[model samples]
Structures are given as structure tokens and as C-alpha cells.
Target: MTGHFLSFEGIDGSGKSTQARMLADHLRQAGRDVVLTREPGGSAGAEEIRRLVLEGDPDKWSAETEILLFTAARRDHLEKTVWPALEDGKVVICDRFADSTRLYQGITRGDLRGVVDRLHDQMIACEPDLTFVIDMDPAMGLARAKGRQGTEERFEDFGLGLQERMREGFLNLAHEFADRCVVVDGARAIDAVAADVARITMDRLSPDAASA
Candidate 1:
């Protein structure tokens, strides 16, 4: 319980990945024991799942299949990477976790609430101390995504409508986990977003996360 786990959530092109790395670097500079990683791609087995998932199309991946794949990856990541570090009191910064499954696979793709919950219980059920939801409009978000033409992954290849629903998914998640989630405007500048994240990091990890 002394260790803190923070997750960065948002639609594609919302700058969450960037912010996660930046925050990790800041924490490291501050002399914190921080271990940076991402869901579905942190461990070797999980990363392979990432490839399968990203390459999966809307028609190919059923809701059940997607959730199963996510949990499989999550199990490997937790066992191989996340839990061990957290046991050592390291601050774990994951790019995305179960929320991504809830959104992309559960909410957007179709209905898999039952499946998602069951898998979470079965594997990768750790709740984060805090989750930063980088919010943004779908169109604007996709425009930013288009900028990454060369590196677009399967999930990042979602169309505008899918992106929009994902945005809603994120918003709904922030609402559902209000006490454990912080919503930031991803539309802001990188440093600006980083500053907010840094301030939050200081507030929580330091003796002040619950205070100013």
C-alpha cells in the first residue's frame, strides 16, 4: 500500500504516452523510485498480445476475444513487471490498463461488461492509486493521431467515430472513478500538461498528494 501505481488514460493521440514518460522522468529526477511501463506491451508476452490486438480489425476481434487478450497480457505484465516493482515500493506508471479494455473493447467495440469484470478479477485486477485521464475532443484527437501516420498501431488506426466513443469511454471512466481519477485537458501544451502532471505527482507521492 505504500507504493503508488498511476495510470495514464485517454483516446489515441491524446498525448497520454508522452505524458507518462515525462512524468516518470520527472519523478526519477526528484529521486523517486519510479518504474515506467505500459499495458499490453510491458512484458514480452504482453507485447506480443499488443501486436495481435493492434493488428486486429473491428470485424476480427469479438468483445470476448479482446478482453481475453488484454487480460492475458495483463497477467504477464503484473507477474513479470508491475507487481514485483510495486512490492519493492517503486512508483509504477502504466500507460494504459483495464480502462483501455473497458473503452476500446467493452464500450466502443460492443458490450463485454461481464467478460471484462470477470477477467479483471481473474488477472490484472490492481487498482491504481491515481489515474490521469487526458481528455480531448475526438476530431481534434484524431487530427493529432493522423500526424503519427508512420507509427499508427492497430488501435491507433481507429476512425473518428470510434475515437469519439473512446473519448466518451474515458469521460465515463473518470466519472466512475472520480476519487481515483484526475481529468486533464490534453489539448494543452506538452509542458503545460507535464506541469500539471508533475504538480499532481508531487502532491500525491510526496507528503502532499491529498493536500495542496
Candidate 2:
């Protein structure tokens, strides 16, 4: 059986990362071979690129330059981490993926959605088998993000305005990729959200669904 690729996406502090980790733990406890990783720093090379992108000032690089950096990091991640684990038939749960770029760069960086798409098509032409977008209000999400402390605050520091825009971008993307994207309301309790994610994931991984 081939491994399944699953990704979790949301604006910063939408609890997507927590849900992703919870799902990974759930799958592991159920005896599934799983590899939980994240971008833009899954593999070593990608980690180096991640620093370049996530550290430094928010405007350290142009939108186009940042896109290229992210694509390069993703390429390295797929080559060194995701592909190999999938080839071994291990479920790969990524915290974030290309959809993040499509939303973040596409929204904050001016009219670069077309360039983002083109770069994705040319370089990282892969999508998760399933993606869960945790939807939440930007105000609440920003509050949650602000509670955390880290030097990797470049993106998180964009504040509530950008997050609000990002929320819309994610919703639109969910509609655009409805066949493979599932939107989960994230304003509820963490356990409630995790339960929803797990149930959906298991249904998707069932024999009938997998064979389909």
C-alpha cells in the first residue's frame, strides 16, 4: 500500500499544528507507520532555508525572492524527507505545505498569486492527498499566536490584518480544492477539533475509501 500524504493548514494560531500533532499521535497509537514533519524545514537543507525565510526582518526579501526561497526549501524537503518516507509507505503528516505559500505569499506580497502558482507548477508539483484547513476568526487566532514566544515570529508578527486576509485566502483555497480539502471549524475546544480531524482522517483511510 502506498503511503498517504496529509497536511494541515491555517493562519498562525488556528491550532492546525496542534491538531496535526494530535492526529499523528493518534495514527501512531493505532499502529500506522507515520512520519510527522513540517515545512519550510523538514529536511536539513530545507531547515537551512527555513531560517532564511522565517528569521530576519519581515521585509528582508521581496515577494518573488521569498517565493523562490520557499520553493527551493520545499523541493529539498520533498527530495530528502517526504518522498522517501512515502516510498516506505509511512503516513506523512506535514504541519504546512504549498497551500500556505499560495495564501501567505499570494496575499501579503502584492499580485503574486500567478507567480506563486507558476513556481509551484514548475518546481514542487505535488499536493497532499488530504488537507485540513482549520478555520478560525483572526482576532482569536492572533491572540493565541501572541501567547507563544519564538524568534521565528516573522510571519506571526504580521498582526491581525494579515491574518484576516489569510483566513479568506484559505477558505477560498478550500473551495478551490474541495475534492481534497476539508475545512474544520477551529473556534471550538481543542479536543472537539481533534476528534473531528481524526474521524475524517480515519474515514479517508478506510479500506473502501483507500481503494477508491
Clashes of each: 4, 0
Give the per-residue lDDT of model 2 (tens digit) for 124-177: 899999999999999988888878877787887777889989999999999999
Choose the strongest candidate by lDDT.
2
Clashes of 1: 4
RMSD of 1: 2.3
After superposing candidate 1, which stretches have Cα over 4 Å from the reference? 56-58, 206-212
In model 1, which range of ten residues has the least summed lDDT? 203-212
Predicted structure 1, TM vs. truth: 0.92
Tens-digit per-residue lDDT, 26-125, candidate 1: 8777677888999878999999988887764546677778788888898999889888888887889999988888887777877877778777876666
lDDT of 2: 0.89
